[model samples]
Target: MAEDHPRLAEAQREHWQSTYGTHPGMYGAEPSDPAVHAAGVFRTAGATQVLELGAGHGRDALYFARRGFTVRATDFSPAGLEQLRAAARRQGVAARITTTEHDVRTPLPLPDASVDAVFAHMLLCMALSTAEIRSAVAEVRRVLRPGGTFVYTVRHTGDAHYGAGVAHGDDIYEHGGFAVHFFPRHLVDLLAEGWRLDEVHAFEEGALPRRLWRVTQTSPGGLGGS
Candidate 1:
């Protein structure tokens, strides 16, 4: 599926492998704060299993496993998924964490209504077009059980690097060997259907204060929607 789209296919392999190879434990050992908070929220909601898109290096996946949630950790990079598998084994949580090489632009492999929650950290903003994002969100919605939660983080349109790179399409820009599709708040509301938006908040991190939109939503109680 990635091969059909030049940008998506191009962003999937070599560059990311090089980036992961440049440093062992690239994203570090700690889980992102949003992942930590989501775990608590999931626990309160009685959710025990999750499907995480772009689960690079297993940091957040491992964190969720430690919190007793079985997580299906996926990424487009084989290197990233391999790293996650090794980390899961080392942490003795391999049974709780499953790793797969997956591209969010395509349909998810899980069965319908199979997971309690769907998660993605910066995955939605990684070179995916608006149409692709809508398909991805719908796939996430499909795999989640009724009323399941969906949480994803994206680079905000206000980010310092938003327009600093070569323009690709829409809000997409390529810089430093990576392409990111920044999202305005309105775009989320526009593309996101079938699910109710619960929150869309601003949060920044890193030295550059990388602006982010942390969004959370819930599928409708019946057939589920995102």
Candidate 2:
């Protein structure tokens, strides 16, 4: 199993607490309105039991719950989970959510084929290595039933905003005092690991032209075949 990088995890905890936890609206360029889109998609698909990996501040969790889904939101950072719990209380949907502390680098504390849907936003990029990212995806698949959906978004490679002129050799990028390891894969590559790709929507964030790709997945046939 991949162990969490202590330094990177600690830095991420502090960064998220000071940024997204304190004022979630300012954490990213997008507003809460986009969550309406996500919620609508989930509702249309009739997803009731949801699991959110790397669920920061429970923004998506609260949105899904408000739309009548039971959500289990998990993150490695306690500080982030605290914010999520508080947000749930403030939204009057605390009863609909179950928050847990989880390290995505290892196996998740969930029964096999138990979850109906899994959501992840801006999580795959946070991983420091491709192996780690694949490990997390495997765990996501493990917790989800066959044909269950995985809704997620990720940063694409070599976008003019974040990756232009930035040399990312085998998944390492350094810029603006922040060193990030990015694993950019084609949609087919994601499907190679037993996930059936449903969609891939690509868009740029603001004027910076930073790209985001929304992808959806369904569980495969066997452990290594899908």
Candidate 3:
């Protein structure tokens, strides 16, 4: 079965191009507070080789590159990647960053145990279903080396600020102009196949007035255990 909801995918692509593509630097310059704080965690991890899934506009990608990490950023949207490339060029860090067009529902175009760290911000919540989220988690596990860190953040299922007309039921929500689904399980459940959870924290985004959770884990061995 196809892993993406066609309508949601279309909405995402169009929205990103219209808003983010035209202003690639905006994402980095004025990132959400949670995003900015999350990036700091990655920087402090001291990873040398990093992979960023769903790297929209490449803000975090460029941020990591500026910190001296070799970063590979991937997203399903070509327009987003193009903007990221342009951003890299403008920052004079194009040589340090590699941008690839990739879908998280499929196997990542990377070798097993290839990267030292991985980050995904605001990517899991857009999956539209738990199965797609699991697929994405599987791929994240597939690409990281043992002890590699996986850091990610997502909308919390407990938020009460959902738009008017929003209905929520078991990890799924139908809301104004769109639908969103969240993995209701605690952070341990999202750990990649052989990874061990290191820390799990939750914070509320003041602007969105929404709750967000962040998790960090370390791969146990060379492969994702079943």
For model 3, how does the per-residue alpha-carbon lDDT over 1-226 read when each residue is reduced to its tens digit?
A: 1433665656655765665656655555444554455556656655588888888877788877887788899988888888889878988999999999887767898887788788888787763456667777877776777767788877766776443344444355655544555546553474444678876777776665767778787777533232
Q: Over the stretch 47-75, how does candidate 1's per-residue lDDT look in tens digits?
A: 89989999988899999998899999999
* lDDT score, candidate 3, position 126: 63
Q: Model 1 — which ten-residue stretch has the worst lDDT?
A: 1-10
Q: Which clashing pairs does model 2 show?
A: none
Candidate 1 to truth, TM: 0.93
Candidate 3 has an lDDT of: 0.70
Whole-model Cα lDDT of every candidate shown, in order: 0.84, 0.69, 0.70
Any idea what lDDT model 1 has? 0.84
Alpha carbon deviation, residue 110, candidate 1 (Å)? 0.9
Q: Estimate each model's TM-score.
A: 0.93, 0.80, 0.81
The segments of candidate 2 whose C-alpha lies over 4 angstroms from its true place after superposition are 1-10, 18-35, 161-169, 176-183, 221-226
Pick out the ten consecutive residues of candidate 3 with the lowest summed lDDT. Answer: 161-170
**lDDT measured at residue 86 in model 2 versus the true structure, 0 to 100:** 83
Q: Give residue 226's error in model 2 in angstroms.
A: 14
Number of colliding residue pairs in each model: 0, 0, 0
Q: Report the C-alpha displacement of residue 224, candidate 1, in angstroms.
A: 11
lDDT string for model 2 (129-191, tens) is 666677788888888877777877767675553553344444545455344554466533754
